[model samples]
Target: MRAAVFDRFGPPEVLHVVHVPDPRPGPGEVRVRVLAAGVQPFDVAVRAGEMPWAKIQFPQTLGQEYAGLIDAVGEGVDDFVPGDPVLGSTMLNGAAELLCVAAENVVRKPAALDFPTAAALVAASQTASGSLLELGVGEGDVLLMHAAAGSVGTVATQLARRAGATVIGTASLRNHDRLRRQGAIPVTYGQDLIQDVRDLGLQPTAALDAAGGEAIAQSVELGIPLDRIGTIVDDKAAADHGTRVVRAGRDPKRLAAVIDLAARGEVVIPVQPFPLDEIVEAHRTVESRHSDGKVVLLIAS
Candidate 1:
């Protein structure tokens, strides 16, 4: 099996694909023939050695989310069978040709959603859903989202809208129309962010920060309470400003709910795709932090 790996992390160019021994599922696990994977900021940080907590070894595999078809199931696994279409979270092995994850963690993929899009939704969905829930966002609340054009931002905006909250998101001027179409009021980033939202006459009762920088401080200046301000990208900022650090843990059920809505076409995710062989480019794309929706890698069968 071939997989993306890095011996000594430094840059996207350091990533490359190499053939490794095929893996078999252990008890209570299922082995999947990966069809697509999502490259995330976390993967970029890991590759650059920015995340000291990540357990990296020489030639370590990269990736956290994938969509694939089940090829085998180990003992005690009864939820999935060969040919079952699924998508889920994995640990640093998602960019490979095959993955073995516990059957309990797998989220069944609807036939309506393609493999790459399903892969894109795995990590972002859980994070968005959990963050909204923790922040108590609901009807009658106006939410201010920093980096609203991002993957998690896109998903969060749609979900918050459905929950009856109005969304005001920060992004580049080019993404303003895209945000408006997603039911959000678009605001640009930087010094005017607070003034931009203020001009809308909508008071932000809650906020989600997926983009770092002064998002936390800006959210504070916008009059959103420290408790209602959540930062997924910067714990330091959250702590410094007395804001909530949204620790949305991985949850298959949370992922399934949003995915089901996506399958029914109630929510939308635009995809930026690259082939698996272009792993270096995919990593660079994620690192660029400019692509809307999710950056996906199409893993060929």
Candidate 2:
């Protein structure tokens, strides 16, 4: 099997495909023939040796989310059979031709969602859903979402809207229309962000910061209670501002619910795709942090 791996952390150029022994599922696990994998900021950080706690071995594969079809199931795994199309989060080997993951973690993919889209939704769906849940966002609340055009923000905005909250999202003028279509009142992010939201005449009852930097500070200035301001990015800023750091941990159930919404077209995740061999370019795109949607590696079928 071939997988994208890096021997030494540096940049996207360090990542390359290499042949490795194929993995077989252990008990309670299933081996999936990966069709697509989502490239994330985390992957780029790991590649750059910026994540202090991440254990990086030479030839380490760096991906967290993937969509694929089951080819084999190990003992004690009965719910999924061969040919089951599924998507889920994996620890580090998602950007590979084949990967083994716990059967319990995989969500059955609906036919309506393609592999790339399903892969794209795995992390963002869970993160967005959990952030909203942790912040207790609901009807009658106006939510301020930073980086609303990005992957996690995109999902968060839609989910918040579904929960009856009015969302004001921060993005460039180019993405304002896209944010509007996703049910968010779009505002530009920067020094005047707080005033911009004020100009809209909607006070943010809560805020979700998917973009780091000054997001936490801006949310604080919006008069939202510190407890109501949650950030998935910028832990330092959250701590400094007394805002909550919502570590939206991976939950298959939460991921599945959002996936269902996506399947039904109630939510959508736009995907930018590159073939698996172009893994370097995929990582580069994610690192650029300018992609309009999730970046996915389209592995060969």
Candidate 3:
């Protein structure tokens, strides 16, 4: 198997592809031939040694979300057979040509959804859906979202609107139109974010922060209840503001629901594709934080 690994925690430059022995599935697990993997800010943080708990060893494998075909099923796995198309969440092993994941964690990929897009949706969809649920975003609520053009924000915006909430999303001016297309009222994220949302005559009842730094404070300034203010990116800010830090743990059921919506063209995650060997470039792109889409590594397809 070929996988993306970092020899040290420093920069995207540390990421490189290396050949390793193919992994065989253990009991209740399935081996997958990975077709694509999603690059995330989590991967960036791990690479840069910013995540204190990751405790990376030298040559650590990276990536969490993957889309692929089942190559083999291990003992006790009954739902998936060889050649089953699937997407799922894994830890530190998704960006590879072959990896093993728990069969229970795997979700079937719809025929209508391609591998790159399916990989793109895995983390963002789980995060977005769970965040909204935790924040109690629902009908008639006015929701404020930071970093609205990014992956999780993009999914969150669409999901909020579908739940009958009015969404006010913060993004760069250039991505304002993109937010608008997703049915969110767009405001530029900055010192004036509060005023910008106010000018649109919407009082935010809930807030989700995918961008860190002052987001929780700004959500507080907007008079959104602290309980309704959630931050996926800024745990410190959430702590400081006494707001919710939405870990929004991975749920395959939630991911599958969103995948079904995406298959029906009801939701879309824009993806920037890179070849598997371009792991360094993919990490660099995710680290930059300017792309209005998920960065995905196309491993074999």
Candidate 4:
């Protein structure tokens, strides 16, 4: 199998394409012939050695979300067989032609989406869905999403709105119209964030920080209760202030909700797709944060 492998963590240049041994499924696992792998800030963090909560082993193949065909099933796996289309995340080894994931983690691919789009959905949508579930968003609730134009932000905004909650989202002035089109009240990041929500006559009952910047910290300072704020970023200060950290597997129900929402077209996978050989370029694009969509690596092609 050909994979993007790196023995050391550093810049994107550290990532290299090389021929590696094909992975075999473990008990209750399935080996997927990957068509695409989703690139995210988490992947960048693994590359840059910025993640302190979790450590990646050396000679790592970095990727979290993937879409592909199940080429083989391990012992005790009965829900799927070879040639089944699936999309999901793995503990590691996602940036490769073959990956082994727990059979329970894989979901059947939605008929309406292709491999690349399905690959893009797992990370951003699952994160957003799980966080919103932790916050308990509902009808008449005012949900504030930081960084509304980005991939996770866009999906979060739409899911919250679809739940009958009023959504207020923040982005740069350039992305305001895009956020508005997704049914969120757009507020440009700055001091005006609070004012913009005020203008809408909506008091934020819950807030989630997908942006993970100083603005998120400042916004949390204003009136929302600490327990009502959740952050996906590495902001320990969010916890210090009594907010929740949206950690691994906080709610399995939320993961199921994201999958169902994707199947129903109420959620979207906003991505900029690049071929696997262009892994370096994809890394740079995601590192720059200039693109408004999730950067995905196409593996099969």
Candidate maximizing lDDT? 2
* Model 2 ranges with Cα > 4 A deviation: none
Model 3 per-residue lDDT tens digits across residues 23-66: 99999999999999999898899889988898677778988999
Model 3: residue 224 alpha-carbon error in angstroms: 0.8
Point out where model 1 deviates above 4 Å. Answer: none
Residue range 1-301, candidate 4, lDDT tens digits? 9999888879999999999888889999999999999998888888888876666777888898889999999999999999998888786688999999889878888677788878887777777877788888878888888888887788889988988999888898888888888899888877666676777777788888877765556557657777888888746767567677776352334655676777777676567989898898999999887776778899963
Question: lDDT scores for all predictions?
Answer: 0.92, 0.93, 0.92, 0.82
TM-score of 2: 0.99
What TM-scores do the predictions have? Answer: 0.99, 0.99, 0.98, 0.92
Model 1 TM-score, all chains together: 0.99
Q: List the residue pairs that clash in candidate 4.
A: none
**lDDT value for model 1:** 0.92
lDDT of 3: 0.92
Worst 10 residues of 1 by lDDT: 284-293
Model 1 steric clash total: 0
Descending-lDDT candidate ranking: 2, 1, 3, 4
Q: What are the RMSDs of all candidates, in order?
A: 0.8, 0.7, 1.0, 2.0
